[model samples]
Every structure is written in C-alpha cells, then in structure tokens.
Target: MTIRMQPDYRLSIAQIVPRTEAEGPGVRFALWFQGCPLRCPGCCNPEMLPFEGGTPMALGEIVRQMGQGLESHGIEGITLLGGEPLAHAPGAAALARAAREIGLSVMVFTGYTLEEARQMPDTAVAELLAHTDILVDGPYVREQPDSTRRWIGSTNQRVHFLSERYRADDPCWRQPNTLEIRLREGELAVNGFPARSAVGLWRRPPWRTPRDP
Candidate 1:
C-alpha cells in the first residue's frame, strides 16, 4: 500500500509527552492521538473518544519537539498511542518517518491486531507499520490486566518486533511498568500503566487545554 503524500499534514493530539520513560524502552517522545472507533469497555482515556476536541498541531511542530527530546533527554524512540494510532495513520506515519530520519526508533500501540491492520485498505496504516520498529497490538481487555509485561495493558495484547531494533529478550521488557506524574506549571498530568487501585488517585488538572482522554 502506498500512502498519499501530504507535506502539510497535521495531527489532532490528545496529549504529548516530550520525554517519558514510562511509554517505551528508554526515554521517548510519546503522542496520544485524538479519537477512536473501538469502545473497549473501561478505556483508559475516555476523554479522547470524541473526534471533535483536541489541539490541531502541525506535523512540523511535532517533529521539532521530537528532535528536542532527542537532544535534551537523549531519547531513543517515539511511541504512538491513542485514542488509536491506526485511526490517525497519516499523521502517525509522518511522525514515524520523521523519527526514523532522525535515527530514532518507532514504537506504536494499536488496538487492531497485526493481521487485521494488514488486511485493512488504509494505505497509511501500511506505511506506519513499515516504519514501526515495535508494535503492541490488540484491544485492551480490562478483564485480563497484564502484570508480566512492562508496557502492555492486557494479556490479550501481543508485542511484535516489526524491525530488528528491539528483541523479545531485551532486559527492558522484563522491567516493571511505571506511572509518571508530572506537576508542571501547576498542572497535574499522569500517564503510564498503573495498578487498578491507583488509577483514581491522580486527577487531571482543571486548566489543561485539549483535555486528556
């Protein structure tokens, strides 16, 4: 599948962490795209379900921030989450390509299984997969929470090393998942996989623009 080129692409962003160790192996720039079709019961970010609200950000700005993450935090990669990355394939692909051009690895978490994604007619989905070094696939099954894998949400999800950039036996995969709480400019933001009991402790700051889902 060949993606249609759009040099002036933009993304509807739910959230963006310029540098976060909780998102993937090593520090990375993580993006949560706005909106998703799948209504997995107990979706972690319900605020992101609607397609309307979110910051409309230019692709170039996102790429710039990614480069800044590399220089300031020495990040090794970028992680694309949701809402649903496949739902925002065009911008995600553009971001993945920009990450690769800067010598950073690309990791994506998609609700669609690899087989399902491949079967889809979306050309940008194929392009995103082509540039992805790692893919965590499958819907988040709230009944089957994952405790064994560092970044996985549920046991139903599978990790695919789409490229040789990472391996199953990597020591990082064995580490425990962690949650990050950021208090910047009096805004409280939390991310990463946390224990079910800990989910209610952190509340989004009232002043946050574009909101978190």
Candidate 2:
C-alpha cells in the first residue's frame, strides 16, 4: 500500500503585531491573517479586510519566527488573530501544530461560533481546533461590548476547551460567563469602550458642528 500526503498551503499573514499586553493570557505575539468574510462593523483593524494585501509566508518561516519571539522575549504563548483564522484552516492548523511541537499552547480568536466551527466544511478547522487549547469564538457585537473585560470582545462569544483536559461534565469548560468590568480609570467603561474612564453623555455639546468646532 502507498501513502499519499497533502501539500501544505502557504498562509497569507496580514500583519504581525507583537508584544501586546491586551490580547490574551500574557504578553504574546499575535498573527493577523488575511481574508475575512464576516466584516463585522467597527472592527478595530479594518485594514485586514482585504485578502490580497498580506505577505505569503511558509509554515516553516512562521514557526521559526514564533520560536525566535518566544526566545527573545520569554513570552507566555502565541495568539492567532485574523481576518479569521478559520478562513485559512489548513495553514493555521499547520502553524498551530508546529507551535504545539515547540511547547507553546495555542489560543485562537475566530469570528465563527463554536457551533459554526463544528459545522465547517473544511476538516482543517477541526484539526486546528484539536491542536488549539483555548478558542474564543463568535463575531463581535457592538452592543455587547467587552467593557474592559480580560479576553473576550462581546458577551455572546464562548471559550471552548478542545483538549482531553475537558472532563465529560465540566460546566466551566462548557459555558463560561461573560465578564463585567469597571475600569480603575474611573466610571465603568462598558465592553468595547476605550480602556479608560467611561464618557458622560453630557460632555458632548449638541450644538457642535461635524467639521468645525
């Protein structure tokens, strides 16, 4: 019998944003991949919308860069953000597998809901999920803001445990609650607000012109 192998797809990385304190877990190197169909309104990095803009990077080069990042900064782990990680499942899975081989846990942020990932046509998404330790899944809702929350952007997104570590009946791993926050900056900043004091509606002058003040 002969064994056939699948060719690895090169990933298009929109941008590599590093040493971010906000993303998740700890100081981490984040990879923002190109191409997202969801196009959620008010997405912070709208520049990542186009699929053709990023550089095409091979799996080996990506892993090497991550290893270098880990060694240079002693960071905790790598977080995969995107135009949508599930968009390039094969490449992302390859990257995540490599990261795991190097002893780094993977955290993936996706616009797809947990149910959506389970229904993805591409088997690669499931493969990537298998390798992923923590998955923050769902599209961002402007009304359901993070409010200076720790890891998620909205109240609807759920964190799923893909590893065997999840017990058969663990509620915490199954349905974690959305976080509520009050910024130390002052008044409570609800989800999606700037990481500072909440703004008072009275502060804005109704008479102010749009272009001239």
Candidate 3:
C-alpha cells in the first residue's frame, strides 16, 4: 500500500502589507501568518494568537500578489512576521522557497530564539531556514530596550544571518546585534502601549456596510 501525502498549502494569514516602509530594508511586502502558542503579555497582535482566527489563503495566490507587488510597485523583498510561523512549518517553508526562487531576499520574525528553533524537530522549520537570509529570533522582553536597535524590540533578541554561519547539522546562529521595534498606532492601540511610529489606519465597522453611506 502506498501512502499519499498532501502538499502543504499556505497557512492562514492575519494580514498582508504590500507596501510597507517598515519591517525590513527597502520597500517590503510583509505576510503576517496566523496562530501563535506563545501568550506573551502585551503582544502587539494578540488578535493573531488564536489558531482559528484568520482565513486560509492559497500559496499560489500569495505568490502571485508578491510578484505583482514587486513588478508594479518595486518592493525589494518579502518579510514573514507571524503569530509564530514555525507552528505551520510546512506552509512557511513552501512560501519561503517560492520567494527565494523569484530572487526576493527573505526575512522572518519569530518568538522563538535561534537556539530554541534549532531544537525543534519539525522538518519544515529546517526548510524554512534554508531559504531565509536573516532571522530576528527570541521572545519579546519588554524590559530590555536599546534606543538604536532596528526591527526588533529588546536587547536579548538577536538578528542572525543564516546564510553566513548557520549549518543544517549544527544548530545555533550567531547573535549579531539588538533589534528595534517601531510601532504604528494600531499596534500600540492593540498592544495597549505607546508606539514610536504613528500611521493612519482604517477601522472597518463590525456591521455590514450599506450600499449608500
């Protein structure tokens, strides 16, 4: 008897920012994968914590949108920020591979430290790392803060360059430097904290919109 395995599709998404000045270097297209196990206090996107919160999208559709973002608006690369992307490792890996194939530099944001990720047994996590150029790893510790870090919150967390020093056999990437987190109004409002960066965001009404407003 043969066992047929289903291909891993793209995981559910909380949001997509097609053109964002923040997240990474250059204009980046960011995908916020849904579902997280870590129930960190004051998490910016607490809405993304529940596994069942968001709608699942097809991998091809995501890739297509990314291509459009690159061609039409000149987005330089893609960034994966998540409610724990490693939770849906297969889907994340598939997406990373797709992005790399198109010559888009990839960056990922995770709650897990580089050491913790190395210890995880999931095969897809390894695959995800294979295509990743940079990883901002570790849990958010609000207590430790440096005024100058870029794209991360605390001093304890590290920005690791995977392609430079990471290996499949041996785990643990080098701790490059501290990261900075710039917050938009929605993030601060949701997280219940003050934010450095402010942006105008549209809030959709809970009720259905009438044909004429």
Candidate 4:
C-alpha cells in the first residue's frame, strides 16, 4: 500500500477531552472525530454521526494539545474515537503518526471490522491501521450490547493488539464494565461502556426524589 502523507492536515472533530482514564489503558487523551459513515444503532455518541458539523482543527493544534496533556496530566497515550475515526482516514493516520512520534501509544475504535478495513481500497485506511497500536473493530450491535469487555460496545467487536504496547492477557480488558462521569460547568458527561440503569440514573434529574419531595 502506498502511504500518502497529508500536508497541512486538518480533522473535523467533535470533541477533545484532554485526559481520561476510561478511554484506554492508563491515563490518556481522547479525540472524538466529527463524522461517521456507519450510523450504527445504539451508538454512544450520536452527536458525532453528522459528517459536517464539527470544528475543523489543524493537525498541529491537535498534536500540541496531546503534548500538553502528556506534560500536564502525565497521559500515557491517546484513544481515537468517533463518529468513526476511519471515516477520516488520512487525517486520522497523520494524527496517529504524530502521537507515536511523541512516544505515545495509539488506540482506535472503529465500526469497520478488521477484515473489512484491510480490504478497503483507500491507502489512508491502511496507513491509519498501520499506526494504531490497538484497534477495537466492528459496528455496535444494539442486540449484543456488551458489559464484560473493556473499551468495546458489543460482543461482536474484536480487540486487536497490533503492537507490544498492551497484551490480550491483561486483566483490565476482561474485567467487568466500568464508567466515569464528569460534571463540568453543571453539565454531565458519562464515559465508558455503562449499563442501561447507569445511563438512566445519569439522565434522572438531580433534584427529583423517589417520593417526589
């Protein structure tokens, strides 16, 4: 595959959380890209589904932010989530390369299965996969929601360790589901593979009581 580098690269990003423990192993920076081709049901971030509505950030700005996260928060690596990271393959590949250059491990979550991604004619997709240390692939299946696996939404999603940064034998990957809730400026944001009740609880108004006090 011919790997082409994108000069003056920019990514359509939904959000960038500087530090998060729930995204991957250890403390890590998380980037959620703006668009997705596969609008799978039960997607955790439906806001990321629209291809055109995110901030178009320069690649250098993103790298600089990652470096800041590493320095200020001692982040171990970066996790790329989406809409679908692979949908923006070239830019995603460039970002991953930049992250690796700074000695940070890269993990990616995608709706494309490994086989499907490998067969894509786009060299950018191949290049992005090449730079990924860990990849969680397969579309989210609402019927097969998974709570036992770490960093994946469904049982059908498979985790691939493309490099030595992490291991399949690691207990963290098989542990029961976990989540993190962040309350910022009176807004609540939940992260991780949370169960239905947890989501419901989060959605419930804080002032409301069981007895309607």
The candidate that achieves the highest TM-score relative to the unseen native structure: 1
- In model 3, the worst 10-residue window by lDDT is 204-213
lDDT of 1 by residue, 31-148 (tens): 8888999998877877777888877888887887788888888999999988899999988988998899999999999899999999988889999999999999999898998888
Checking candidate 4 for backbone clashes, the offending pairs are: none
Model 2, residue 7: what's the lDDT?
37
Query: Sorted on TM-score, highest at the top, how do the candidates line up?
Result: 1, 4, 3, 2
Q: Which stretches of candidate 2 lie over 4 Å from their true place?
A: 1-9, 164-213
Against the true structure, whose lDDT is highest? 1
Query: Tens digit of lDDT per residue, candidate 4, span 1-213?
Result: 544455456788877767777778888888888889897777767767899888888887778888888888888899998879999988888888888889999999999999999999888899888899999999988889776777667889899999988899987776666577767546675666562213521332221221111
Ten contiguous residues with the weakest lDDT in model 1? 204-213
Candidate 1 vs candidate 4: the TM-score winner is 1
| Residue ranges of candidate 1 with Cα displaced over 4 Å | 1-7, 195-213
Q: Local distance difference test, per candidate?
A: 0.82, 0.64, 0.65, 0.77
- The backbone clash count of each candidate, in order, is 3, 5, 3, 0
Instruction: Write down the TM-score for model 3.
Output: 0.75
**Deviation of model 2 at 145, angstroms:** 0.8
For each candidate, give its TM-score against the true structure.
Answer: 0.90, 0.71, 0.75, 0.86
Per-residue lDDT for 1-213 in model 2, tens only?
A: 111123334778875544444455555666778888887765655656678777776776667777876887666667888778999888888877877778777889999998989898788888888888878898877678764344566777777766653333544323332322333223332221242113211112111211211
